[model samples]
Target chain A: MSLLRKGQQWGTFACVWHIFDATWQDPFRSAHLIKKYLMGLYKPIYHPLNQCGDHVIVINSKEIALRGDQWQKRVYFHHTGYHGGATWTLAWELHSKDPTMIMKKAIYSAMDGTLQRRFTMQRLHIFPDDNVPKEILENVSNQIKQLRPVPNRLHEIPQEERDKIPRLIQYPSDYQLK
Target chain B: MAALYRVLNYLGKNVVLTAQNRNISLSAVTRIKEIIQKKEGNTLTFEAVIKPDPYEGRFLKPKNGACAICSSGLDIKHTDVLILSQFVTSEGNILPRRITGLCETQQKRISSLILMAQYAGLMLRRSPKGGLLHPLQKRKWKKFNSYYDEKTIKARYK
Candidate 1:
């Protein structure tokens, strides 16, 4: 809930939510967290090869916080799969590359390295902002959830192939408004 | 002679609990393992006690989120072996039974876990013998080259 005030800050559209560690019985207050906890519980029993977990949409991606000077030091890696193709982009620079990565990495880390990790991760959706056309929210655990985690256009580019694709094409054309 | 008899009895589907305490406390620790060191009784080797039912055939199929046990559900301490075994193995290849001393059935189950980990990007799909480094990558370089083809390069120079 930090106010937006920056020198060169760009806002993004994401399916954002606050990840609270503790559980809440008030479904309306912390419905998304409750659902994530429940879905995570099912992961031990459910098949990992197939998409079993539900998508968690994060809104207001720009508002997410970092504990310390972590934002300035944190870096994301992408390899072209060639000699000297490894590119290290910072947390802020990646906002231009793909604002959603910050959220995606967060969810991916939580899943750890379970066998169903690949399939269960498919359901995770991270949007930068809420200013999109006809946003779909479904009711699951006593609270409404963003049924679809990803935007209409998903980033299917491989890690090695990301540099080949133009950054402009990464976001939906209408994202300027958000 | 008794050790051979015990092995034969266990493999032949004859439970010999009627004999003296069969739990003979196998020495679980080996020089080869550099993984987590817990109490001696906790760490059992794949060859030492793993008894997978080869006839079952169903254990070959990996369950969702579960690692391969003697072709059965995830066994204790064996979960720790899942990550360590993959790390010790040379690369993308799965470890076979003969060297690991695991029975045929348990070996198959562990192999599937390796495949699943690779698919999840936790492990490599191929070995690093020669393929780890990509070399001789030739891309269309236009540093000082001419017109239309050199447009992007020219703009960068400016």
Candidate 2:
């Protein structure tokens, strides 16, 4: 094979590392996108039996946002294999116990329940904050886009930018100013 | 003759007495003013000056008879704090339709969006302090981040 063709083959098969920011992102929705990278579904030569999956490192797992009242309404079930050992934990309670547990469980449940599921999960790394190990951080070459843009708080905006927005309504001449 | 002489003496002094009629009410007065007190020589003068509008000619106006929000055709979400803040008072209360000039449906929609933004903690500065806890300090699940879907708002106009 030509040298250029050999280089392209090596590039196609090489496993890459991707980074994702979970700040204000919906974990369930993000799981679907992360699953694609974890299983290497984007690869042109991907196969069910092939080991072409890439590694995904998620940062700010604690900041993952849920839609509506999911934090209070969603429940996580646990069983200790004993009589009356089954327990239900609310999403917020689970998050308080371990910040990364919700994010980890989200990605784990997103994939199919196969024998390789556990093995595939080993390639996923989740951090509660941005403090990733140097060795792992060195390998990340790409970043996965967030599902939704993070909203800005009104108090956090600077005074100059706040002054620039056009006024939509003018108070009546006789209206009292609060 | 003595009573006429007393009246002539009072008129000769050139003193003018004026009684200004004012209505007293429990509600706040709409006329906002800045009171300025000036002392010159031996006389003190008090003046109530009307405050000027900061956004005089720059107000967003719709060309047609439609409301500004409807005419602009901007798909406003709860995250758009800049636009949403315009429809609220300094205390974060939604302005009345008479002052906002928004249609009934648009008024209802904007109010709902403001509520969602408050729950999400995007417009905490404008929120009124009624409860014991501060608006910035949320408890339990309320502290966490949450978003809303605009379609979930039930502002149906028949």
- Write candidate 2's Cα lDDT for A16-71 as tens digits: 89999999999999999999999989988798889999999999998888899999
TM-score of 2: 0.84
Candidate 2 stretches with Cα past 4 Å from truth are A1-8, B1-49, B125-135, B156-158
Chain B TM-score of all predictions, in order?
0.30, 0.65
- Most DockQ-accurate candidate: 2
**Candidates' lDDT values, in order?**
0.39, 0.85
Q: Please write out the lDDT profile of model 1 over residues B61-89, one tens digit for every residue.
A: 43453324432443422123233233234
Deviation in Å, model 1, residue A32 alpha carbon: 12
In CAPRI terms, where does candidate 2 land? acceptable
The numbered model that scores best in TM-score is 2
lDDT of 1 by residue, A30-132 (tens): 3335346425443433443433345454554543433223344668788999999999987656655565666566656655577666665665444566543
Residue pairs with backbone atoms closer than 3 Å in model 2 (clashes): none
